[model samples]
Target chain A: MLTRRLSLFATLALSLLLVSGAQAADIVRLATTTSTYNSGLLDYLLPKFEEDHPYQIQVIPVGTGKALRLGRDGDVDLVLTHAPAAEKAFVDADYGVEPHGVMYNDFVIVGPSGDPAAIDGGEDATNAFATLADEGATFISRGDDSGTDKKEKHLWEEADVTPDFKGFRAAGQGMGEVLKMASELQGYTLTDRGTWLAMKDKLDLEIMVEGDTALFNPYQVILVNPQRYDGLNTQGAQALAEWLISDEGQDLIDAFRLKGKALFHASAGEKIDPTSAVHESD
Target chain B: MHELMNTAREALHLLLSFDPALWEIIGVSFRVSLTAILVALPPALLIALLLARVAFPGRWFAISLVNTFMAVPTVVVGLVLFMLLSRSGPLGELRLLFTQRAMIIGQILLAMPVLTAMLHSTLQSIDQRAWETARQLGAGWWQSLWVLIREARFGVIAAVLAAFGRIIAEVGSAVMIGGNIEHFTRTITTAIALETLKGEFAQGLALGLVLLLLALVLNVLLGVMRGRGHQTVSI
Candidate 1:
C-alpha cells in the first residue's frame, strides 16, 4: 500500500512539473503595488491583454518598494508602481529601463464620519496632517513602505510634524487592510482614489481631504534591465510594457471604472513632472 | 551567494546587538502566546480528564470532533475570528479585533484542540488503578485527579510544550487578527512576514533564527522529559 501511494505521489508531482514547464516559456511575471491589485484594475486589464498576446502575465501584488526591489533583484520581469521618485532612482541606477507613464490617480485622506480631527473638506493634505497631529487624532499609516506609505511620510514631513504622536499607528499592511484598520480604529489614513472607490462602501470612513497637486499619483511600467540579468523574459516584458502605453491599452484604462466612476486617467506619453525623465513618446 | 552571506552576517549582527525593534517583536510573541497557553491549560486538562474517564454518550464523537478541529488550518480560524469581531459582525460591539487580546483569543482556540487531544491520550494511557486507589483511600475528587495527573506529569508537560510550539510558530491567524501593528500586535512571525514583503531580509532572518532556536529548545526539553518518563516507568 505504501509503495502504491509513493508511486501515485511521484506521478502527480511529475505531471505538475510538466504542466508548469509547458507554460514556462510564455510566463511574464509583473510585480506591482497592492493598490492596483486591490482596486481590481489588473483583473480587468490583464485578461484583455492576454486575449491578444501569447504571454500569460502573472501579477505579484506587493508594496511599491518591494515591487521595485523585485525588479532590481531580477525576481520579476516588469514593475508597475506609483512612487515616481523611487521609480526614477530605480531607472537611474540601471535596474530598470523604458519607464513609461501608464496611468494617473490621486491620494485622499480619509477619516471616520465623526471627523474628530476636523480635517473634512480640506484641500491641503499637508495642513490637514498638521491638524491631525495637533489634535492627537488617531492616524493609521501604511508602514510597509508602499507608494501610499511614502506619500503619507512626505506629507508628514511637509507638515513639519513627527508622526510619533500618541495616536499614530504604523500598520505594516496593504492599502485595503490599512483602510479597513482606519475604519475599525476610527482613525485617519491616506489612500489612493482607486482603492478608496473600490472599498469605500464597506468602510465607515469618509474622504476628508483631496484635490491637492501634491496628492497626484502616477503609475509607470518599467522593464527589468536585461543587461544586468540573465534568463529574463525581456521580450514578453517589453511587449506588455509597450502594449500598456498603446492607444488600445490607454483606452481600456480610461474605460475601466469602479462604482460607475472612473478611477484612473490614462496618461500614456505624458510627463509625470518637469523633472522626471520618464516620457516615452516625446 | 554573496548576497546570501551578507544577509546572514547582518542577521547575526542584529541578533548579537539586541536591536530594540527585533526584541520588541520577540517580546510580543512570548507575551501573547504565553497568555494564550496559560488561559487554555486548565480547561483543556479538565476536558481531557472528562473525555478519558467519563463514559458519557457521544464520547467517541467528542474525540473525533477535537481531532477534526486540530486539523483545521490556522487561517480558517483567523477568518472566522475576523468575521465575528468585525464591525458588522455580531460581536462588533466588543471591538476586540486587531488587538493583542484578539490574537490571544485566536491562539487559545488554536491551542485548545492540540492540548486536549494530547492530554486525553496521556490521561488514557495512565493505569486505571492510580485513580481508583486514590479515591478508595478517601481522597476527594480533586485529590484523585491530582494523583492521576502526577502519574502522567511528563506526558502533560510534553503536551504543553508541543502546543506552545504549534501556536508560537503559526503565522496565519496572528497576521489576520493581530493586523501586524508595529510596537503593538506585531509578533515574531508577523514581523518576518512584513519585513520580507518590504524587502528587508536581515530582520526577518534574525527573527527566523530566534524561532528556530525556540524550536530546538522545545525539542530538547521534550527529549529530556521522555527520558525521565522512561526511567520512572522502568523503576
Candidate 2:
C-alpha cells in the first residue's frame, strides 16, 4: 500500500511540474501596491492585456515599499507603485530601469462625518494633521511603510508634530484594512482617492481634506534591471510596461471608472509636477 | 546564498539583543494563545466527557461534527469572525473588532474543536471501570468525573499543549481581526507575515526561529508525556 501511494505521489508531482514548466516563460511577475489592486484598476486592465498578449501577468499586491524592494531584489519582473521618491531612489540605485509615468491620483484625508478634528474641507494636509494632533483625535496610520504611509509621515514632518499622540494607531496593514479600521474606530486616515472611491459606499468615513498639492499621488511602471538577475522575463516585463504607457493602455486607464467616477488620470510620458494644484475634473 | 547567510546571522543577533519590539510580539502571542486555551479548557473538557461517557441521542453525530470542524481552515474562521464583529454586523455594538479581545475570541474558536476532539479520545481511552468504581465508592457524579480526568491527566495536559501550539502559531484570524496593530495585536506570526511582505528578512527570520524553537519544545514535552503515560498504563 505504501509503495502504491508513493508511486501515485510521484506521478502527481511530475504532472504538476510539467504543467508549471509549460508556461514558465510566458509569465510576467508584477509587484504592485495594494492601493492599485484594491481600487480594481488592475483587474480592469490586466484581462485586456492578457487577451492580446501571450504573457500572463501574475500580480503581487503589496505595500509600495515592499513592491519597490521586490524590484530591487530581482524577485519580480516589474513594479508599479505610487511613491515617486522611492521609485526615483530605486532607479537611481540601478536596481530598476525604463521608468514611465503610468497614471496620477490624489490622496485624501478621510474621517468620520462628525469631523472631530474640525478640519473638514481643509486644503492643507499638513495643517489638518496638526489639528488632529492638537485635538488628540484618533488617527489610523498605515504603519506598513506603504506609499500612503510615507506621505503621512511627510505631512506629520511638515506640520512639525510628533505622531506619538495618545490616539495614534500604527496599523501595519494595507489601505483597505486601514480605512476599515478608521471607520470602525471613528478615526482619521490618509488614503489614495482610488481606493477611497472604490470603498466609499461600504465605509462610514467621509473625505475631510483634499486638493492639497502635497497630496498628489503619481504612479509609475518600471522594469527590474535585467542584467542584475538571470531567468527574469525581461522581454515580458518590457512588454507590460510599454503597454501600460501606450495610447491604448492610457485610454483604458482613463475609461476605467468606479461608481461613474474616474479613479485615475492616465499621464503617460508627461512630466509630472507633483506640487501643481490640479483639481479632479468632475 | 551569501545574502541568506547574512540574514540568518542578523536574525541570531536580533534574537540575542532582546529587542523590545520583538519581545512584545512574542508576549502578545503567548498572552493571546494562553488565554484562549485556558478559556477553552473547561468547556472543551465538559463536552469531551459528555461525548465519551454519556449515551445521548446523536452522540456519534456530535463527534463527527467536531472532527469536521477540525478540518475547517483558519482563514474561514477569521472571515466568519470578521463579519460578525464588523461595524455593520449584529455584534458590532460590542466594538470588539481589531482588538486583542477579538483575537482572543478567534483563537478560542480555533482551539475548541482540537481540544474537544483530542480530549474526547483521551477520556475514551480511560478504563471504563474507573468511573464505575469511583461512583460505587459513594463519590458523586462530579467527583467520579474528576477521578476519570485524573486517570487521564497526561493525555489532558498533552491536549492542552497541542492546542496551545496550534493557536499561538495561527496567523489567519489574528491578522484579519487583530489588524496587526503594532504594540497592540502584532503577534509573532502576524509580525513575521508583515516583515516578509516588507522585504525585511532578519526580523521575519528571527520570529521564525522563535516559532521553530517553540514547536521543538512542545513536541519534546509531548513525547515525554506520552512515554510517561505508556509507563503508567503498563504499570
What is the alpha-carbon interface RMSD for each candidate?
A: 1.1, 1.3
Clashing residue pairs for model 2: none
User: Which candidate ranks first by DockQ, i.e. highest?
Assistant: 1
With candidate 1 superimposed using the best TM-score fit, by how many Å does residue B8's alpha carbon deviate from the native? 1.4
The digit string of per-residue lDDT tens for model 1 on B95-159 reads 89989999999999999999999999989988888888999999999999998999989988988
Off by over 4 Å in 2: A1-27, A44-56, A239-243, A246-252, A268-282, B132-144
lDDT of 1 at A281: 13
For every candidate, the chain B TM-score is: 0.97, 0.97
Model 1 lDDT vs. the true structure? 0.90
Clashes of each: 0, 0
True contacts kept of 2: 0.78
> Residue A63 error for model 2, in Å?
1.8
lDDT of 2 at A273: 43
